[model samples]
Target: MNLIKPHDRISLAEKIGRPSVALVVDDFYNRVQTHPTLAKPFSIVAHWQEHKQRITEFWWIALGGKPTASYSYDPVSKHFLAGFNQTLLSDWKALFFEVTHTHLSPELASAWQQRVEMIGENLLRQNDKLLGDRGRPST
Candidate 1:
């Protein structure tokens, strides 16, 4: 059996660090705010700075860094409320990949991108189930 467990492995948070993560989030969100398709969904975000900070923290913890602040991230509910359709999610993923690739090393970007795919897929599935039960897919 493998000696290193999932939690025991060196985290991407440690390797990529918070700075790079924050940089990507900042840049990506900036572009997203102005993006034709992305802008509409993101319009719900009241404060851009606050959103970036929280998202940066979210990614940091997701990549296995220790939490520096407490937060209750209800992403599925939020995205459902935001009316995130497949197109929006697809655009988000493409833009995110672009930003990460520009900001991080190829290997690091690939690693982080994989995690994003897994989480995003799960989010999409959960959001779809919830929204579908309500008799409509998010637009």
Candidate 2:
């Protein structure tokens, strides 16, 4: 079965551009490092620069851009190991949206934000199944 991403081939990365993707990733993580609730959950990352670069690629691919590198991602495993919970995921999403709005125009940011919400729901489900952390975000 050829699995297609839910957002399909919209090429949002091309529309939003590579530089803005990097900007969002960098800005989001930079805030995460100091976020009162996220500081500890994200403390697992030892290298901010490397993490940001990888995540930039992740967003690029998720937004329908062609892959620029061969780096593999296992978000479920990574999030589980990071001790992710509903609260952290919620905070992460909030901060992520905040950063995107800062760097991207309203329409592009909303488009990317919709895909990210899909990712968030998936992560929350998988993390719960693997780690037995079952809870909804504090919405």
Candidate 3:
């Protein structure tokens, strides 16, 4: 899928809103568990089921643009600091796009893909600056 235009992103995010975000999280977690590269890292968590549900809720909150009374940590950094690396990130994003393509409509999938690509690009940039280049060069 092609990257979504910036103007379309807001509408796409609105389309996803809360429920779609929950569905994406649920689908993503299931895919992660089944994925060979991701399964092991996911297994490291003590409460996989609970963690998965919380992640789903977290996405709902994030995409819904709701105000947060409680502080929430960024899971990507949390995982990375815990030793998850670029390989995992790449694999996860691959699976994520796969799931998105399979589950969401083309327009929604394009929007989500663009958002994810943006986030992934930023994360890779930060990771490179902090840790030095540890994987293939960022696209």
Candidate 4:
């Protein structure tokens, strides 16, 4: 009983809205903060409040919305600076997909995960350089 179909691209921002997006981001970060392997890399980020706010805006714009100033940070560089390795990135992706699938419809989750995988690929290719976001910048 899915509302979406193949080749049907909808506005995820409109589908999920800001509140749901916030909830997903909160849950994702909260889970990551407590993860045994992932927690170490994120431990340097003491400003969880601000990080969550910026990340929420990042997802909002990424999912399909007007880009806010807060969403302009380079995620790949940030992760590299946080000392994220390949295993950490893989675990992070797994956790992200788990959290996203929990919050979004299957169709929406698939679409978002596709974008994330592409971004992850580009991030690996760029090697700590800025890959930027999906909506405004090229991956």
Candidate 5:
């Protein structure tokens, strides 16, 4: 018997469809908190809950492809400014992949993976330009 059952992609979409971006932020925050290296960076924010909501909204905007009336800060710039290196970025990607694999359907997983990879690549490029090759030193 196949231990892994197929997930309902429609159901997953529906679940993500409801409510505000807070859910995604909460999930991201939870993952960051549990990660050894991520926890410190995530803890830097004084208002974690608010930060989480903003991050969640950012993801929602990226995935949902909708217009965001609120928040004007750019996520890519924020992350780079946060002093994240390549290892931390890789850790973030790994955690994201693991979370999607465990919680999302195959279709959703594929979509998320593509989206994250694009974002990560862009961030890496931006970081390289800003801090030089010594900053991340790609691995």
Candidate 6:
């Protein structure tokens, strides 16, 4: 139940071009990869080039575009595996909005903000639920 108004849910694929998405993904990851709290887990990423491509594809899909060919990364699993605690997720969300604000107009940024918040919160909740389940015995 996303309470976001229909008009606030503009298509990122249509409003923001793929080139802009690519740029944001590149810039965002560049910063994240070097971020003190984010760097270590990302160090396991063997190929920066491929990782960036996958990130771009992820943004493309998230922004309401058709799925990129074979872009199937599960963000929650990856983040959980990498031990992303609440503080790390908060930092990541903060940086994400900062990057988006730099690239988009206020309206577009606001629109994307709602969507991003919803997605991030959902992922965090799901990750927590799954982690909790892991500690319980199977039925």
State candidate 4's TM-score.
0.78
lDDT of 3 by residue, 1-139 (tens): 8999865566444677666776777788877777888888787768867776676655545454554345465755666665556777788788988888887898888777877787777776666665655554433
Task: Write candidate 2's Cα lDDT for 70-106 as tens digits.
Answer: 8999999988888877778778888888988888889
Best by lDDT: 1
Off by over 4 Å in 1: 1-8, 133-139
Per-model root-mean-square deviation over C-alphas: 2.5, 5.3, 6.1, 7.6, 7.3, 6.2
- Best model per TM-score: 1
lDDT of 6 by residue, 36-101 (tens): 888887888899889999988887888897775786777888877887666777788889889889
State how far residue 40 of model 2 sits from its true place (Å): 0.8
Query: Which of the two, 4 or 6, has more TM-score?
Result: 6
lDDT tens digits, residue span 100-128, model 5: 66656667777767888998888878877
Per-candidate local distance difference test: 0.90, 0.87, 0.69, 0.78, 0.70, 0.80
The window of 10 residues in a row where model 2 has the poorest summed lDDT is 130-139
Better of 2 and 3 by lDDT: 2
| TM-score, one value per model | 0.89, 0.86, 0.71, 0.78, 0.74, 0.82
User: In lDDT terms, how accurate is model 2?
Assistant: 0.87
C-alpha positional error of residue 114 in candidate 3 after TM-score superposition, expressed in Å = 0.9
Count of clashes in candidate 3: 0
Query: What ranking emerges by lDDT with the best candidate at the front?
Result: 1, 2, 6, 4, 5, 3
Model 3 TM-score, 2 decimals:
0.71
TM-score of candidate 6 to 2 decimals: 0.82
Clashing pairs in 4: none
- Candidate 4 accuracy as lDDT: 0.78
Winner on lDDT (2 vs 6)? 2
Those runs of model 4 whose alpha carbons end farther than 4 Å from true positions after fitting are: 1-10, 68-71, 128-139
Ranking by TM-score: 1, 2, 6, 4, 5, 3
Query: Which runs in model 2 stand beyond 4 Å of their true positions?
Result: 1-10, 132-139
Candidate 4 residue lDDT tens string, 1-139: 8777744765777687888788888999999888989888888988998888998888788778666674468766776677655677689899999988998898878887887788777776665444335222222
